[model samples]
Target: MTLTESVNLDNCDREPIHVPGHIQSHGALLAFDAALRLAACSDNAERMLGFALPALGADLDAPQFAAWPHVTQAIGDFAQRSHGTSGLAERSEVQVGGRVFDLILHFNGRLVVAEFEERQPADREIRPFTTLANGALGRLRLQRTIDDLLQVAVTEIRSLTGFDRVMAYRFRHDASGDIVAEDCRPDVEPFLHRRYPAGDIPAQARRLYVINTLRFIADVGAAPVPVHTAGAEPLDMSWATLRSVSPIHIEYLTNMGVAASMSVSIVIGGELWGMIACHHLTPMVVPYGKRMACDVLAQLLASNVQTLLAADHAKRIEAASSVRVQLMETFVGGDGLLAALRPHAAALCTTFAADALVASEGTETFVHGGVSAAAGAELLRWLRSSKPPEGLLAMSEQAKLPPVLSAALAPWCGILALQMDDNRHDWLVLLRPEQVETVAWGGRPEKVYKAGPHGMRLTPRGSFDVWRETVRGIAVPWSATELEIARGLQAELHRAGGARRAQVARDRDQMLAVLGHDLRNPLQTIAMASQLLARGADSATVGPRITRSSTHMARLVSDLLDLSRLQGGLGLAVEPKPADLARLVREAAQDVTLGHPGVEVAVEAPPQLQVPVDAARVRQLLDNLLGNARQHGEAGRPIVMRLEASATQVTLSVANHAPPIPPESRDRLFDAYKPASLNNSRNPGGMGLGLYIACEIARGHGGTLVYEYHEPFVVFVVTLPREARAAAAGEA
Candidate 1:
């Protein structure tokens, strides 16, 4: 039932406002086809142009065209000059009904449309074009800063147009606008510094603003004179100055108590940068000429603003480059990431204009600067939950943090974060303290609705009063340069850390390779010892020596099997069965003694001691211990082997004269780069893996291999349960 209802909430953006079916009452529109025939005209065409378009089927008489005969030649000249179906061409003047009018020519689709605007008394000579242009351009050229430029623009435009209020509204990054500068009569309330929501100017409206640089509404309340078409398509009045405004915009202006309004777009680099908006309390006309002058000023302002903004950004980046260079100088990978950053944490906080820095490696956390430990932990916890693998976050508000941590990290209003791992761990975070400020809005920006024919429809707020809000929990936004530098550092740290881990793994693999090759020596000894046993040396005496040598060879293959698999070699696996433990021990001693010709091994054990075990692996364990003793024990000192059996277990002791190993250095003897190599098992290998291999073999048999530095003799004892675990052997 209402005009605005046609442009309601649902179809606000989709509405075809551009092809609105009418023109304002102040002007009349006439559209003619290429054949010089009138196709459409406004309802008031007879009153404004002294003639009207004939009906769809009728023909026009020569007398009918006589009233506006100048239009025929004007259309041809306008079309030739335009080069396209856009941009209105202003005619000097046209006469109708004994009065002068301003006629603008343009094309809409295939039709040439001409809008004729009536002139009031004394309308033409407000100020000549050259005089107005020289004065306005000269005054604008004097402005030095953006603020001064905006202020002077609004002041001069108001003086030129004689409007009640004028403002230089600049768009924010969000597309919202601020009344950055204003010039109005003393009676008018000030709207300077007031903010308007982005919704105030919808997307489609912004697009039109750029296309039609000058917009004018002479009166808000008057109904538009509908256009009548005769066998023609709906005419596009996009470039027509007298096109009717959207009904919703009409109501919006009405609500503001603005009788007339005008605006000129400030477009820069093909974007709608801002606008020069003028408002009048009473119906007023901004003649087409005056509106064009304001349009030119807006374009000049946009160009100026663009240049100043670029200069500002360049200066900021130049200043920030020094800080980035300094940080990189201290960030080489020779020292680990945490170690390198620890001493510079405080300086980094200041460099980023932040209050704290927290670097976490998932397991360890390093914190520095003003934040408390609890707050730093809370920040790490937030990032650990929210950040994805190799993800980045730059938040300038504390409220975005989890509710639980909001209180603990309240003092920190912003965070720049980088996470390296997928498990939500390992992040470098910088936190900035809160910066509080007050913002003044044109009105409350909340959406309000009114009951309409189609349920609820969004309506403009009635008041334009300043609504103040104290904004807190916000921080100065991180600049593009700062973010770029942060990402660079993050990438470097991640690269260095990954390389270090890879290097560690390579070193470990190399050690295993050397350990596996060390097995060849023990294997050779077992071969030589077997030949002596086969030479008919008396079965009762040499039989135990043969069994022990076989056991030592098994341990050597077991240790090398895994290394072989890793290095593209063979795998030695096992299937356990019953075996004689005492005989194996004696055999291992024979091989070790043969390997060290200067040392003699004295075997002491029962002739037969049985157990369920990997017999070869048990022999291998003995070989490692005996060989180590033979190689490192004092020369000419007999290496002694003592074997004993119980109902549930068997025990073997191999002892030789040597200096006692210190307790502090004994723990890693079986593992760390062969501490056994100190005196017990040193070999041509990278780190003598003899002790470590011997220990693992004992474990695989559910047995124990232990080192005992009994005074004056370094001893290794092996204990085997009656039944071997064989779990390690099973995996192999």
Candidate 2:
């Protein structure tokens, strides 16, 4: 037979579990029509309820049911009170045939379903709920791993319910299940480590498992009775405790030699993660209270499972982060990209267990281990053509490869790649070699044909004989943790590339702005001076104008270059010698007075204040400061230049009467290209680089430049060491 024919794939998911047409022998079920007439009863009704099956049209209050008068009134009261709802009534206890039973009633469509189960004796000793629950919780808490936890859960549940076998079956990403942990009777064959296909529990059945956390079948071999209704419709017994089960499921259980079964769902993050399945070789019924306890246990276990999984995930992320830090450091500290990643290539490839790694930038390819150069080129071409997502792109099998590239990449079955840049064709690829794996399936995982009352139909596999198959053309599966780490690496690389591009763009724009605005006036002045000389104007007048314009242009260019060098991590080059500070201050003040003839300048300093310094750079520093004071300071105010000498340091203070600096601009005053104020109309000609250059000069001389606002005046202070040893050492 063909695979599909053998497993009966057509009927796998068609089983109507809600209307199974059967009920457990431990309970008696009866359905009444809209007229309140007894329409149907279970075949075992006479044995359990001490009453023969009622005729199809007999009244529900017949003489056989008169022994319990409460049943008739209870049904009437339920029908009246449960309006506009599911019509399920609260269970009531009644004595019939000298035996107490718990009666549950609910309306399904036009029929009312009543089910009865034998109640526990009044004198039977019951175990304390708190004791059992606390013990189980304590044992569960002591488990440090998921395996230990599952083992404890199945053992405790089986012990509590007295089932012959209990297994913790965990679902995979594809909805297939594996028996992770089990506790069964020693005489029975173990189902541990067994796997089941996803089709075994159809989609609809999985939905019901989520809705109803727990389900039980007292006996799989019990006879079913038709749930009759005057309208010829079947009742939906999805929520009924004693509802009949599907014949296919019954056959499935019987094939395994199981007479009863129970299942409790284990949900995590609002999704069904797995289930706790229980089975027995003989018919059995679990009490409501015990089932309630199992439900609580399942909930607690689900919570613990979430916590443990999160902890494991966090641990993996931490390890990956460490590796990422090392890789980034190497990339940043080395000369070229290929050379940087080369030293750490093995470490990077091992993160996801790939046999080879390739780093590609444009047409250049750097291989780490076993990947061929042709394969790398082909992979890159495919990646560029496909334009995959920004994060990690993973392919588990070579079949996913393009036809043109599949034969070239035959040695590698899997590829995990990440694009490092959004605008560039730079990629990091990890390749895994083809791995052949042998998987032991419970059966062929195909449907089989069978003869039934309705003629030939599809059925589930009846024989669970071990069927081993060797799977080829695939590599080892990539784990969630590995994929997460790959995504993180991709994000980090993208951010780094974006930052570098942004810096380059900023630099280009700043250069353009300076060339277009700040340098235009100086160049124009030179042109005007040359035109005057060419026109035979007075030689002396054109000479000074030409000299002044050229000097100004040179100073602007020098300041720009100095700022660039400082930013590039090359500090100012200076030479220092013993000099008279008071003389230097006097000369700087005289130069400022020449430049700004209208402004009054005052100098206060002791004579012969000697210090070791670079006189020219210090002069440049003073010129920039005094020039800034003239441009932004009040026009009529006197500028004060003061020099103070101490044992080990000299302080130069320049003060002017000007409006206080705005709070927003104070922090970025010494930053290159940052305007002195947002309202640039006040000081329009300045390039905002003077103060930045001044600060760099002061730092080069082992001094600091700072600004302070004093209500009516702003002060710029320069403090330098008297000996200037740092400047001398830097010069060397």
Residue pairs with colliding backbones in model 1 are: 548-584, 548-587, 548-588, 549-587, 549-588, 551-619, 551-620, 552-619, 552-620, 555-620
lDDT of 1 by residue, 297-404 (tens): 777777788788778767755655655455444443222345456667776776677788877653446677767767777777777666544578988887787778
TM-scores, each model vs. reference: 0.63, 0.59
- Cα lDDT tens digits for candidate 2, 549-663: 7787787678767767765545676677888888988998998888768888899999888888888888888988988887788889999998998898999988899888877
The Cα RMSD in angstroms, rounded to one decimal, for candidate 2 relative to the true structure is 13.6
Regions more than 4 Å wrong, model 1: 1-9, 12-15, 32-39, 55-70, 80-100, 106-112, 119-121, 126-130, 230-235, 333-369, 384-390, 397-400, 411-413, 418-435, 451-457, 473-732
TM-score of 2: 0.59
lDDT (0 to 1) per candidate: 0.72, 0.75
